[model samples]
Target: MSSTQHTDTLKNVRTISTLLYWVCAIAIIFQILVVPLVWYAPGWVEASTSQMTVSLADLHALSGWQKYVTMAVMMIPSLVLAYGLYRLRKMFGAFAHNAIFQPEPIRHLKAFGIALLAQTLIKPLTGAATSVLATFHRPAGERVLSIGLSNAEASTLFLGGLIIVIAWVLGEAARIDDENRSFV
Candidate 1:
């Protein structure tokens, strides 16, 4: 690419990185307020007709700290997702600063990939656990143990693999660049 195109691409990356950084920051901050928000805003938190099989009212059925545990079970993956987005923001920032061949961006990519993989694996387990917890206060007939591998999870797993492969390819390229420098 020409200098102008590269500079424009860097500008675009920097803008996207900034947007993602703010989004991640806000998501992480919002996670801290979930319990209170659920307490005060039941209608907003609980959507009975939504695609979500279990509503906040279902989670509200849990007694004492068990409710918090259920919330944590749900929120933890979101935090992981936020952290992954933050890592991607950092990686994009590195690209914006012309640090493509450096270790830091590669490390960020690897971390983000691992985070995505972890989320993909944990989501089904957490969903089942959350369903069981939500049923804790429900009648026997209403209780359920559910698990499934959705398309979203599959796509995320694929994206995680793609990111890891990209990171490995970049690492190899960096090593080759170093070797070439040595030959000069």
Candidate 2:
């Protein structure tokens, strides 16, 4: 291909990639904010809908403004990070196809595995933390960190969080390998 054609192709790829990166980032951000709020909302608003008791005592305390701020803070970055990592994978894939060191994809894959394993560790820890929080809650509604949520609920949240992070890390690792392979 002509040099100009190659340059145009690269630019097109970059544009497409950047758009996808932002989309993923936005999703992650939405998850971050929405998950926690939604998680906590069960007992207050939606419990009847579920035909069960679901306490979101933890989130009940946040004022309207605080909720918005907290939601943005938590969700936006979560999305950015996840989306960035996912984008990395795609970018690397392209690099692998074009570059010399195709073997790098293996490295990325391994790193993804490691990330997944590492991410798995967080839920249990979060659970432990939640359990600890629960003990101190004493039905007092005092502490913000009170492990008020049932073990099952907390575990689910923890697990979901872990999965998100692990998925992101795995994506990043995979991309790394892609880039590596591209160099060869």
The prediction achieving the highest lDDT against the true structure is 1
Off by over 4 Å in 2: 1-27, 30-54, 58-105, 139-184
How would you encode candidate 2's per-residue C-alpha lDDT over 43-138 as one tens digit per residue?
Answer: 444643231121344334455564555444434333433543454465455453553233353344344344334433443444334433433434
* Residue 39 lDDT in candidate 1: 54
Q: What are the per-residue Cα lDDT tens digits for candidate 1 across 71-113?
A: 7786766677667867876887776676768889898998899
For model 1, give the 10-residue run with minimal summed lDDT: 45-54
TM-scores, all models, native as reference: 0.80, 0.37
Assess candidate 2 and give its lDDT: 0.47
* Highest TM-score model number: 1
